[model samples]
Target: MLPKIQHLLKASPAVTALIGAGTDPITDPVRVYRHGDAPQGVVRPYVTWSVPAGDVENTFDGADADFFRVHVDCWSDGDVEVEQLAKAVRAALEVEAYCAGYYADERNLETKRYRIGFAFDFILSRE
Candidate 1:
């Protein structure tokens, strides 16, 4: 991973380093708390992602290194709900450019609530 990606992941309050841990291509989504302070009759969905390494490019002027990409998938109980949450998270992360995209909903055969899922990808690089 690029230094910036590593730095960000290492700095996450929800993450910890596991010594001698094997590196795998991570594409799994994790669930997290939406907010620390709860509101009256409101619940939020928040998720954090691990940084995954991508390709690297070397150049004479400077090495344009694309270290990795990080994605946080969020879900909410209504449409555009996940999108809004994702936007907030992106803003907090200071990633200026991203694509807000939607995907299929995952649910069990039993009880289900109105669920929405959206994702935004981040590309980290240094030249």
Candidate 2:
């Protein structure tokens, strides 16, 4: 797991509240996980992220900085629902670039329930 991913997980109080943790009961508070294996049974609405590949560099100050290719996957039962969840995630990440920005890539799923999926790619930095 990426260290930054864990950091975001741990530092999620504000986000949790904003995304409906204690206030809403049905949303399940937009569950989040890292490197979670898909179960043999059911998969609920959630967000999963992973570091596909990355590099660590030792700077002149003798400290290492890690640049990771992070992929965030958002899943829900509806398009608007998944999009709302994705928006919340993108807001929390708050990442930006001059040329590259957030884009939604839809995925098709074969399941017992109708599902919508969205993906986002980002270069995450950790020192």
What clash count goes with each model? 0, 0
The alpha-carbon deviation from the true structure for residue 89 of candidate 2, after best TM-score superposition, in angstroms, is 0.3
lDDT tens digits, residue span 1-127, model 2: 2445434533555445433353444544445666733444434556666655567767787575655556666666666666666655655664331112443456555752323233433443444
69-120: candidate 1 lDDT, tens digit per residue? 4444444554455455544544444443354454435542442423334444
Error of 1 at 46 (Å): 1.5
Predicted structure with the largest TM-score when compared to the true one: 2
Model 2 scores what on Cα lDDT? Answer: 0.51
- In candidate 2, stretches whose alpha carbon ends up further than 4 angstroms from where it belongs are 6-30, 40-43, 95-104, 112-127
Question: What's model 2's TM-score?
Answer: 0.61
Which candidate's lDDT is highest?
2
TM-score, cand. 1: 0.42
Off by over 4 Å in 1: 1-44, 51-53, 77-83, 90-97, 104-127
